[model samples]
Each structure stands twice: as structure tokens, then as C-alpha cells.
Target: MSSFEPKIVTFLCNWCSYGAADLAGVSRFQYPPNMRVIRVPCSGRISPKMILAALRKGADGVWISGCHPGDCHYIEGNYYARRKFTLLKEMLEFNGIEPGRLHFSWISSAEGVKFAEVANKVIDEVRQLGPAKVFIKESPEESAA
Candidate 1:
């Protein structure tokens, strides 16, 4: 069998986490290439449906990152995001999704090192969890076959 490499779907807030990721790239910080980033205007813009969709589409792991608490560009956006993430996490776990398959963090634009570190940590955790099998939405033909 071929080696397994988990596919991580990362939702990053444009004002902070995305900038930190960009900084990490520009600074040449080493990190795994397992993440597929989706930049959002703010963390609060990420809905539960978006995360669930990623999982259903076969993401082995999902990560959502934003500015530090009280540091959102939209003032209270991160606060809202934090609440949403907590509830979403609980709901997913209740429905049998592995806890290690989802993650959340706060990373500022100046924290490129932290960004890289978190990226490694997330990748390692997902690798330990192995490939995602739950909640994947196979095509109708595949399902029929």
C-alpha cells in the first residue's frame, strides 16, 4: 500500500492567520505541505456548514485560525468565531468525528514562528489519526457501485 499523507483543510482569517502563514512562507520556515488554505475575510465568516463540507469532501483534518482574542480586525469577530468553533467541535465529536481531526488557534501577523510550529503540530496530529473515513460523501456512481 502507498504511504498515507493526510489532507488538511485550513481556514485562515485574512487579517491575521493568513498573514502569519504568508510571513512563515516568506521567512522560509519549514512546515509540511499537507495544508490547503482557504482565506476568509474574518474568522467569524466561517460557518459550521463550511467546516462540515470540508470533512464531507474528504479532508482528513480541518484547522481554523484567527487573530488573538480581542484582536480581531472587525472588533468582535474573533470572539464570535471562538464561540462558533467550540460549539462546532462539540457537535462534530458528538457525531463521531475524531477530536484530533479538528483544530483551532490564534496566530497574529507577527507570529510567523508560531504559525510554522502550529502547522507542524497540526500535521503531526492528523498523521497520527490517519486517513478520514467518516462523513465522506462519495459520488452517486461510486456509492451505487
Candidate 2:
């Protein structure tokens, strides 16, 4: 039988990580297509509720990507995202969520190669950890049904 394809949700900053991902595609850098990319104006826009929503929607892994330090178009958006992700990591752990289910990284618009590398690496890590089933929340409709 074939291996399972883990569903990954990636939040990419429009100014950086999203461009890098676009570059990766233009450069023909091959990577798995298991990820659903969500383009945000800044990584800082990724709220905890959005992250939880992805998991609740059946995503097996989540990735948050932003500009490299000091390269954010919004000046300090990435810094805030970094800090928020750090706190989110701790909160997830406190709730018994596996740390491996979430990842954060910096990718610049010029780093097409880096984007592919990070994509493959994250995929590998999630694969090794298997599908994330813990901490999944039931939707209100599902609960009612």
C-alpha cells in the first residue's frame, strides 16, 4: 500500500515566504504538493485561532513562514510572528499537543532553493511523526450530528 499523504497547512507572508514559494515553483524545484498555502500580508497575521482552525479542519501539520530577520516589509512583523509562535509552541505543549506538528521558518523572496529545502525538511519531519491526531477539536456541527 502507498504511504499516507499528511495534510499540511502553510501560512506564508506575501512579501517573503510566498514569493520564495513562487520562485521555487518558477525555478522548477520539486517538492511534495501536500501543503495548502495561505498567503497573508504578514506572518504576524496568523492568529492562534487560525492555527487551531487548520488542525480542526484535518491538517496534519502546520507551517508558519515569514521574512528573514530584519527583512520584513512591515518592519517588524516577522519579529512579532516569531514571538507569537514561540508562545504558541509553549501553549501547545501545555495542552499535550505534540511539538512536531507545528513549525516556523524564515524564507526570503530570493531564497527559492531554501524554500524547497525547508518544504522537504518539514515534510520529512511530519512524515516521521506520522499524522497528527491529537488535540483535534470537533466542529459544533459535527458535535450536534
Pairs that collide in candidate 1 are none
TM-score of each candidate structure, all chains considered together: 0.91, 0.91
Task: For residues 14-89, write the lDDT of model 1, one tens digit per residue.
Answer: 9999999999999999999999999999999998778887898889999999999989999999899889989988
The CA lDDT at 55 in model 1 is 91
Clashing pairs in 2: none
Model 2 bad stretches (over 4 Å) = 136-145
